[model samples]
Structure formats: structure tokens, C-alpha cells
Target: MTSSPTRQRGSKELWLDAAYEMLVSDGIDAVKVMALAKKLNQSRTGFYWFFADLNALHIAMIQRWENQNTQNLVDRCKADATNICTGLFNLMDCWLDPSLFDARLDLAIRNWARVDADLEARLSAADRVRIEAVAGMFRHHGFCDEQAQVRGLTVIYTQIGYISMQVAETRQDRLARVPHYVELFSGINPSPHEVARFLARHV
Candidate 1:
């Protein structure tokens, strides 16, 4: 009898994981079938079993990023918390934690969208969802619709700027600024407990 395939040799998740790493580390241009196959230490032909083509692989990578970084973050914010500020703090954790956020992947995808019209449209849709999620967090705290929307935009836009600019700041510097940004976004200073929890997760 023929032996079954080895887990290390090939799997959809393995391919997507390798592609994600490449896209984050080397940019989208480097996430090719042969490149991934080489990284995974498998034959390029094995890729066809999991993905139809390169485009399909790229699509899968986008979905993977969306599910992990976007949907997961929003869901965590929606988790049971004491109040809206706590929920917002949960969301901010995504930015502070590299494993949860993947800012490099986000930057790479935004760069890809610059040249790909389809990706641009998809990214625009995602931004709408993300902005609405942020607005919901504000509304939960009794903010008016307009105020919530404006605050939501401010938080997300500030995060995008921080990521895209690749700002160089020490971890201590960023930790010190967290409470200020939290207050700016929510219009209330976070409690000592909240700040401690947030810092504990990051620092």
C-alpha cells in the first residue's frame, strides 16, 4: 500500500501560512507558487492539489488575513467586557500585539491594492466594515451616531497612519502613549485596572 502524504510535505494551511509569511516579509511580489513550494520544501506541482492557480492562492491569503486580523479583532471587541472602554481596549490590543495584528501583512496588502483595482475595492469594503465596528463600540457607550462615526474614523485612521509610516519608537515610548490614545478615542481616561490589563498583554 502507498503511504499517505506527510503533514510536513503539503497542506492548504501550510501553503497559506508560507504565503502569509512571504507576503509580510518580502511583499506580495515574492508570494509565488514556486517560491512557496520552495519554502515548504515540496514540489511545485503539489500546489495544484490545494489551489487552482496563483490567483486562487492570493485570494486565500487575503481571506486568511481578513479572518485572522479583521474578523478576529472585531469579535474580540465584542466579547463580554465591563464597558465600552474595555471593549475598545480589547481592540487596541490587536495593534499592540504583533501576533494578533500583522501590521506588515496589512501594509503589504494595501500596497498591492494600489496596483490592483479588485483588491482596492475589496479593501474599501473591509474598511467600511472595520469603521462600522469601531462606531458600534462607541455607540455602545451612549455616543451619538455622528460622534461615534467621527471617533471611529479617528481611531482607525490613526492606526493606519502609525502602521504605514513605520514609526520608530521604543516599546516603552509606545506603552506610555497607550493611555493617551485610549482617552483620545473614547473621550474618557481608562481606569488603572484597564491600563494595567492592556500593558500586561503587551509589556
Candidate 2:
């Protein structure tokens, strides 16, 4: 909706997206209602129409992150579980796609969790759900439970670490190493088709 005074009606996403942008670019502390109102060029009254308070907006933001990052990641991985290579490729897509994944937001929430026990527990639960989903994908490919767990953790933790570290690498540079990384993570060299498919997305 337009932010003009004529009609201040706006969708929940409009407010949430503004808040998310602030969270990612300026950290969670900057996601206040006043900042959001200013960012959207709308009056503070519009915010109350959508969210009860700053805490409500924060809860909505966290829920959005959980749905998009954790639940959706698991579902995508499971969708391609018939082929482990494809499944791995799908899982890696979360790392490669900005529209699908927001590393900045991920890291920001993790940092937020460090001091908030409830948020920490939420993140911990999301981690477990993600790990199990990836591990199930591996198990579907015939890996034993223990091996699947290890490989699952390897893939999940590796991506988290890559994101958490804020690694600096050009798109082409990372794409160049995709094949080798896939093989190392899955212990099976990706087929020419798989490699091409992956590079096609990232590059």
C-alpha cells in the first residue's frame, strides 16, 4: 500500500520487509517502530494497525525467518531426496540463492540469540530440525544412520560456518570450487549434469 497520508494501509510484509532490511543492514537494535515508520515514510499509526508493539513485530520477524530458512530448507531437501546428489544440490541452493536465504539475517538472529535464552532455544530447535532433515536425505541414499548424522552435520555446519564467517569470495571463485566441495561433502563426485546444474544457478 502507498505510505501517503491519504491511506496508510499497508500489508504485513511491507512492515516486516522494512524491519528485516533494518535488522540486516543496521542490526536488530535499529528495527524499531520509529525507524520502520521513517523508512517506509509512513506514520507510526500505520504500524499499530499491523503489529501490536515492537515485540509483536519482532515475533513476526522471527517467525518469518524460521519459516523461510529452517522449515522451507528442510522441505526442499526432502523434495529431492530421491537422488542424494540432487538433494545435496537442493540443500546447497539455500546457500546460493539470496531470495531463498538471507545470511545477514541469519547471522544477525544468531547474534541476537547469544543473549536471549528463549531465542537461543528457538534457534537450537531450528538447528535440530535442519540437521535431521538433511540426515534423512542422506539416509534415503543408503548411508547408515551414524554416517548420515556425520555427513548431515558436515553439510549443515559447513554452510552455517560459511555464512557465519562472512567469507569473502567472488561468485565465480566459489563456483569454481563447487564440484570438489560437493564431492567432499557427499563423498561422491557429482555427475557432470549435477555440476553443470549447480554452476548454472550460482554462476
Q: Please, what are the lDDT tens digits per residue for candidate 2 over residues 2-112?
A: 446436746688999999988888788788888888888788988998999999998999998998898778877787444777778887788777667778889989988
lDDT of 1 by residue, 34-145 (tens): 8898888888878888999999998998897788778866776677768767888888788778777788888888988988899999888888888888888888878899
lDDT of 1 at 71: 87
Runs with alpha carbons beyond 4 Å of true place in candidate 2: 1-6
The CA lDDT at 119 in model 1 is 91
Residue clash pairs of candidate 1: none
What shift in Å separates residue 24 of candidate 1 from its native position after superposition? 1.7
Off by over 4 Å in 1: 1-4, 7-9
